[model samples]
Target: MPPPQTTGIYPSDSITEVAQSLPLDPLGAGSADLLAGDVEYRLHLIIQEAKKFMVNGKRGTLMPEDVEYAMDALNVEPILIPPRPLPLPQFQALTIPSSSSHPQQIYHLPDDEIDFATYLKQPLPAGVANSSGVKWKAHWLAVEGVQPAIKENPNPTQRGASRPQPSSTSLRPQARTQLPQELQLYFTRLTTALVPPSPTGPETEPERHRLAALTSLRTDVAVAGILVYVVKWLGESIQKCLMAPTGTIGQLVDAVEALVGNEGVFLEPYVHILLPPLMSIILTVPLGPHPSSSSSNQPSPYDLRLHASQVLGKVAEKYGRSYPGLVPRLISTLSKSLNSPPFPSPLGASNPPSGRYEGSLLALSCLGKQAVKSTVWGKAGENISRIDDLAGRLYTDGGGKKRNPLIRALIKCLSVIINPKPVDITPQANLDDVSEAFGPNLANMLNKKLWTASEILRLRREELEGEGEGGGVDGMEVDQA
Candidate 1:
């Protein structure tokens, strides 16, 4: 009667078909329907239990091994029996290795050895370089033998640096660590060109891939996963760009601008990799000179900075809203790099001095966008203030480098911080024609004010010292003033 109305998980007729198909129809006719009902009920119970295993493991897909593991945990024997392994040929079981023979060896049997020659024959893709980058730094925790690389804090380096290498001396366990081959070659070619800055602009390949990546950044949901690659490419390009001011440095700058300005994609994920290279370029001394100049091939230090400045400026603009730590971190990095009371403000070639930093001053001006002015002033103002005090205290009547680029940059950065945006003035106000004091103009004011302050303080102190030295006037009065 209409297959029992097909209401149950399994219809009676379907069960009868199963029963009839069996060699001996042990459950005859109506009885098959009863058995089917019982089977379906048990199956439902097994699945409900199986799902618990899935959730506990934090996996969406169910695996056979998981079912077996779950069943064992539940105190229920699994239905599927795993096949027995082929018996090992009887050679007497090997005991622990003798200390005298090979003390380095544990008790592994010869049969367990792998066939290296056979595996070695497998071919790898062409132009694939071994990325032997990540190395374990020696660090100790609770005990000597326990490696910090393992157990916790596994990988300290970003993914882009060399792939993780297997440590030979690492405690007991170690984990050993592709761009396409042609793409790899193109990146290499690009870096080489940057280092030398030959006449050839980068081949179309890198530019094409960069465009592709930019496109994918907009459309692809999985772009975040491969951000390491993108960051690496741009960082390396910036690094190379910093090395020399010629060749196709502009392309690298463009790459940085594009990556930073990409609207939809969030670079917050890869900022760690991105920031270091960009900063290094920003502050790295002697950005390569112009290729064409015979007298001094290197571009003017200021010129070198302009490239770095544009990139850093774009980054600050895009990320200033989301990431608060950037400006503060940048100050610390710049502060440490400076030669506190810095080498007396880079004297130019004309002064028979070591270098010039006008370019750096200009670059820093670009970086001080209006977005994070207050944060820069409040959060990092102290460091700049300290440097300012030092720079002033050490100031002399003589001007060597014309200005301290670091101090000048800080001053320009401070002005922007103090006045985050352009000051609105009435048409009749005295300052209407004025623009922001950026670059050399700002540097001139900063250098003058600092020099003036130092000179006045020194003169007053000198006068007091001279009076004390001669007439021995009240020392207490001089000290109080």
Candidate 2:
């Protein structure tokens, strides 16, 4: 008989499309009619039964009302198939054979057959007879293998009697108790021969050699002493130079730059001292009396301020993360400078001199960089906000129409604050806002300067990823470039 053509029943186009798109005889049979009989009919029956199971209480077979009830309950359009009389005898006959084979399978016994406690207590078979007995034997063998051959004594002392006793002497040969008197004299004579002659006498070769060695050691000691003294002196000199109005700002700046430029010096223990004084100098510069004022006639200290600011900026660029305490102070100093007027202008204008404004802006920019550091971000979100607020004010009040150096400085500061690197520190609300405000600007600027900034951002990301792979941040920075 020719098979009935497949028909669509679903309300939506999707289901009908799916059914039609399915190739007829997907199993590649020559005719679609091959899927039309008992096998296909049984599959349809199972699906209908499953749908009935999901809705109506189970009965022997699904009824027409049950299908209608399911369609309404599930909110699906009804799908109908022609019903065939249930082949109860055929199904019963198939089950009879399968049920008869079940009893012979004792190993895969049902739970009803298993008395778990009795099975556990049963004596292990003397030898493997069946699969169950073999499994029991295998388990026993594993347990036996793991059992300790020599039982440990619960009351035993921590150290066993078998432990080796310490010997009176070391295993290595002891150094000779004492040099022979003649050998000691011979060494003394040899040492004397190496010493150079001194002014007092026509010394023997031994005496002269001994003198020479002593003189060389003395000279080296003096040189070392001089170096130590000079370092202390230089440190003091730099400190005085920073504080004194008479001190040469040029010399102090050159010294600071030299000290910082030498990577070794910057990383040294004493570098901390160099920073605060240098930072102080930088801070003091922008706040110095304006060059246009009567005070400007008296060799303005403005140049000193510029040098200080430059040094501070360099320090921040190189070691901002390493020295966290410096960041807040730098920010505070920059803030004060930004708020203060340049020395009173000759024209009585409240505005600072151009140079003072420029220096102050540069200092603020450096502070911005420090504020963006991860350590700072983690704990000083408020500080970051302060930097943003200051920069925003400078940008807004200063006006974007003019291309002043201060504007450029403010822009740089904004960039640093916005696109801060992620650090171990948790960010505060203020910090988050600052980061958000600056982030878009950073993104735009970074996109334009991607070639230059890519490596830096990549390194920062790598550091962040590496931080996760590693346990935590404690020892991580030691290995960072």
Candidate 3:
């Protein structure tokens, strides 16, 4: 047999083929064998070096980058490979007829070259803005020993600051009493804007500043740090303004509205804290110092009560579904105010004002139709008797000198509760029927619109009953009668 052939992973035939690819003649069998051994040894050495990189990097697999690093470390020229194409081109083979009646097979990766001019003429792909290329930006990691008020920073209320370790001698963690400097500055600006040194003139600098501050409270997302403190301040301010001997509660009402309307700050958790101040404003007997008995023309802070009621309504509308008991609690508080007797100065409280009753009624109306039926028109009709008693008292108190807002509000409540549909045929309103339904004092003050609507609704209900078609008619149509 021929001299025992060397058995190795890389065959001498592959080395011969590689040499044929270059500008050199085909190697002799012995020369090819020797060259293949050297090539095989070099590959083994490079792989052994690459394996070290993989182990150091704590990787199970040796990546191509590791091989490149190995080549650089060993001062060996690395083989250059082009980036992978979308769908990699398949390897193609070509055959050439040789003179010895045998064919030579050649394999290669084919490239389809394009002219530079043609490449330039073609429309380029649209590029996205700031999508490609490396870029960097600087953002605050911390400022003045506190995280900056930025989207990157967590809310102080939610992800609270880490507490410091207690000393070995003590077991309790020290509580932080002072607020952050940023929060202190913000609170000062807000309070100053809301309560200027002098009264805010109409469309003046102070007015603009006040408006701007309210707008910030309504829209700013950075108020989380001072939110609890701000709410506490608002509660105290509202109570003081309502209890003050003089001045309108407009500013306090506006501030409360802004705080409640803020989408950024969650107020539901603090609803208990908020409710007392709002209820006091809505139901307090005298919002400002009792308008002196001599000054009968003084304006009642009735409008302020209406404003507070509106804010209360908003709170209910926003959070009612989440807290199912909210509406009922509000109705209960308002019912107490509406049913309260007018004359007494209950020990510590001032004489109850007529405007308190008006505010209660409007507040009930604000809670929508279902609330009206529940409170104004009760399931057993007990509230109706109570309202009649109230109407009589209000009429007696006014003594026909001026229209008590309470009576006007009661009439409005009656119209709202009835919610009558329009009638085509004109029918006379029998005051006798109205008087029988709602006591004489209330019936006397019923406007023509309310009388017509109530009579039509009553007539419709009677017609439905006569037709034997009712357990309370729908829309209560009375045209046939």
- Model 1 lDDT, residue 391, Cα: 43
| Tens digit per residue, CA lDDT, model 2, 1-481 | 5445554332234433444698743333323333344345554655674565544455776666566544433334567754667433321122233456474322232234888879967866656544352543222212322322233422122223232211111111111112344434433342233321221233565445544533433333332322222233335554544323222344445545644564322244455556666655554433322222253222345456556667777777777678776667767665565555435332234553444444555666555554434322323233333433443443434333242344344444445545463566443333232246333223333334443244333434565677677765655766683
Q: How many times do residue backbones clash in model 3?
A: 0
Which candidate would rank higher by TM-score, 2 or 3? Answer: 3
- Tens-digit lDDT string for candidate 1 (185-241): 444443333223233323555445545544444455444434445556566556654
What TM-score does candidate 2 get on C-alpha atoms?
0.28
Q: Clashing pairs in model 1?
A: 133-162, 289-298, 289-299, 290-298, 290-299, 302-359, 346-401, 347-401
Cα lDDT of model 3 by residue, 1-481, tens digit: 3534666788988887788899997675578777777888999999998887788779999888779877755546777755655576688999988988778999898988999778756654555334675334468876543456677766433343332111121111111123566667787788778655455556899889988999988899877667766776777777766644222366767887898889988777677778898888877765565322233333356666667778988989999999999989999989887766675432223333466787888788778777777777664334655776675664555423145566556555655656464566554566666666555555566545555436534744565566565544633665445
Candidate 3's C-alpha runs over 4 A off are 1-178, 245-247, 292-299, 340-343, 346-355, 379-382, 395-402, 415-428, 451-481
lDDT of 2 at 331: 71
- True-structure Cα RMSD, model 1: 21.6
Winning model by TM-score: 3
Cα distance off (Å), candidate 2, residue 73: 94
Candidate 1 stretches greater than 4 Å from native: 1-197, 200-227, 247-250, 264-266, 289-299, 343-481
